[model samples]
Target: ARLFRSWKPQLALHAETSGKNAIVVTAAADLDGAVRDIVKSAFGHAGQKCSAASLAIVEASVYDDERFLERLADAVRSVRVGDSTDLDTTMGPLIAPASGNLLRAFTTLDDGESWLVEPNQIGDCLWTPGVKLGVQPNSWFHFAECFGPVLGLMRADDLEQAITLQNATLFGLTAGLQSLDPVEIARWTDRVEAGNLYVNRPITGAIVRRQPFGGWKRSVMGPAAKAGGPNYVLTMGRWTDSFPNCATSSTSEVDENAQFKEYATAWAEHFAVEHDPSGLAAESNVFRYVPLYRPVIVLVGEGANRDDVERCRLAAKVAGVTMIVSRDDEADLLERLLTIRPSKVRVLGTTSDAIYARCDELGIPVDDTPVTSVGRLELLHWTREQAVSETRHRYGNVRVRR
Candidate 1:
């Protein structure tokens, strides 16, 4: 968590919490499968997986039954712990001895009355119930990921409270619910903050081909869609190809980087020849020289000034590109947007020398074409490459002189 805060990693895909996360089990829906899921997600691999269930928010109706709680605890105890090399070992040790010490600290951090569940004394963890709940939403342990064999349990009065408890955290990677009512399941699916949701199933152990996995909010910084499925491949790269026309237009004589003075001439004589006039410089004074789907464009370092920023915005709109302006160059703004499945990301303007070098080092294509008044030509040429259609006959293959 400290590393992420200090370094601000460009691409952070959170499948779990940095603080404690919650698992909501309604009174009407407890089953053997739910208990098994709680055991697997809460204690599997020593609760080291990001998808592990860190907290349990059971309904008051079921939690009031002391017998149920004891049974659940016994199930947790059934999990075996030993050297991972032994195939029979169901749990493993912490990455290091220090990790065990840190988890020990978490147990005492909260004052709330709780039950201790230790599958392995090597790194025994804590579990707290929300019944008669007192902890605030901002509790660091309540929202931070433990990354160990620790799970918290809370009791909710009803379905709504359970959902509220589940959604309180900053992370929204995966969530599991057990219910027989179709309407209740629908409500849970529609409202749960998680990107990956499971009904009547465990939150962990998602198969690649079967379940596309990813998350929302701080849980994932990139596209919120699943990574294991079809959408996953779209993030790899983007391509564009539009050849320039041999014949020149009126603007061909002007400086490629200079601002335009004769919009009427350019519109009537050149752009309007093949493109629709209405779409090309509508009443908004916004221009659309080329057609790009939904490309993400990052404006590097405010780009000279406010006018420069406005210019990039106009150009992106005309080209159908989404623009994000930021001075921080260390962050991979493109990858963050790519998680949402943008067509492609186009980087414009200047950034730090390190960032430029890093982009080159990582093979992330960078377009440093100057955003001068004549930048429209460059934008047009760039958009040509983003053609997604089979037929390239929409416009002439006219290239702008760089």
Candidate 2:
């Protein structure tokens, strides 16, 4: 009561003692009246403590409730605004002019979209009216923490979006949801990220004594820095006087350099496995096929010879090679081969010399008889000779043995 009496000059005589703390009463409403009464007695000792009501999310159904708004407006108008020396004053100047400037800047963003009461109209001192209203959602104005008598309003498409937007802000200091639906209120109360969440009541009307007060995000700083809690202190004590080799201690020992070396070795080994074809062959237990720089042409009997084409395709897929098939009309096949531009062509059943003469005229290199039937030894030799001649013609400087 002594604390209340001391600050009563600046805050009117609405101060009360409810529990451990002193509280200064400002505005009271039906739903949050008990909580506000408790809050008044809790922080009442702080002379300059101005509990500003920041936001009020009225349900869409209450849009035409002029009586409710009028009552709120009347309560705001009735606030005694004056200097600390005035006994009848319910509000006083802010701690600093910078605070006043911040509040002014915030209110101005509403432009003509919202209503902002002039600070001077409310009191000769720095008491600004405790409420502001807007008809629509202004993204610029919706998200902020105005410490003083500044508030913003935004309409949601539905109750869900309203709850979503409420929890979207990084600041989770305190929040209030007003709804008659028990399930709806429960859903909001459970999901809202605020440290102090209230249902169907004003956020500003938090009981300081019964409920611990604190803010989240940038609103708070340092350890145990939450509002309305015991201020914390750090201390140190000496447990050991003897000097020891702390570096050799098992708990303190570290091998960061060795760990880094081990990681580097493992990474290098993994890289080698990924890039090396021989490693892949060893792992898969398959014959490693080496690819030529140029494409390969394989002469098959006909298009219906699916077995040979399948073999060629499998080999091409494995070795990353291209296979060109030759048909009966050699001219058409040569034209198709020109399209393919293969480096090596394996001719089946054709002699090397005859294939060489054809390739010489066409300016192509031939690799003769890479694979042939068991009884085609004579054909393979003849094909090899043709390949040698074709290679010599393709590179005139190189020699070919018959």
What tens digits encode model 2's per-residue C-alpha lDDT throughout 1-402? 234323431211211111101111112223244233222221122123322334454444433356555655555565666676889866566565534534554346454345633334343336555445563443544554444544444445456666666655544555554443445644664455444444433334444333335443322222212233222111011122132222123443323343333333433343112121222211111111123435667765332333334434444443345665665466666566657655556554443344444543443444432231111111111111000001112113432222
Model-by-model lDDT, in order? 0.51, 0.38
The prediction achieving the highest TM-score against the true structure is 1
TM-score: model 1 vs. ground truth: 0.56
lDDT of the structure predicted as candidate 1? 0.51
Say what the RMSD of model 1 is. Answer: 15.0
Candidate 1, 180: how far from true, in Å?
1.7
- Local accuracy of candidate 1 as per-residue lDDT tens digits, 1-402: 324423543433223233244666776674565677777777776776777777777778777777767777777676666776888777776665534434453444456644445323444332221121334345655676667766666767888988988888867776777664557766876577765566655667755544445554456433333555433454333322132222213543322133233322343454433221223221111112233344545545644444445555655654456666655546665355435444333445445555544443333334443443443243432342100001111134422211
- The superposed Cα distance between candidate 2 and the true structure at residue 179, in angstroms, equals 4.0
Off by over 4 Å in 1: 1-21, 98-102, 116-137, 239-402
True lDDT of residue 55, candidate 2: 45
Q: Candidate 2: RMSD over Cα atoms? A: 34.8
Which lDDT value does model 1 have at 385?
A: 14
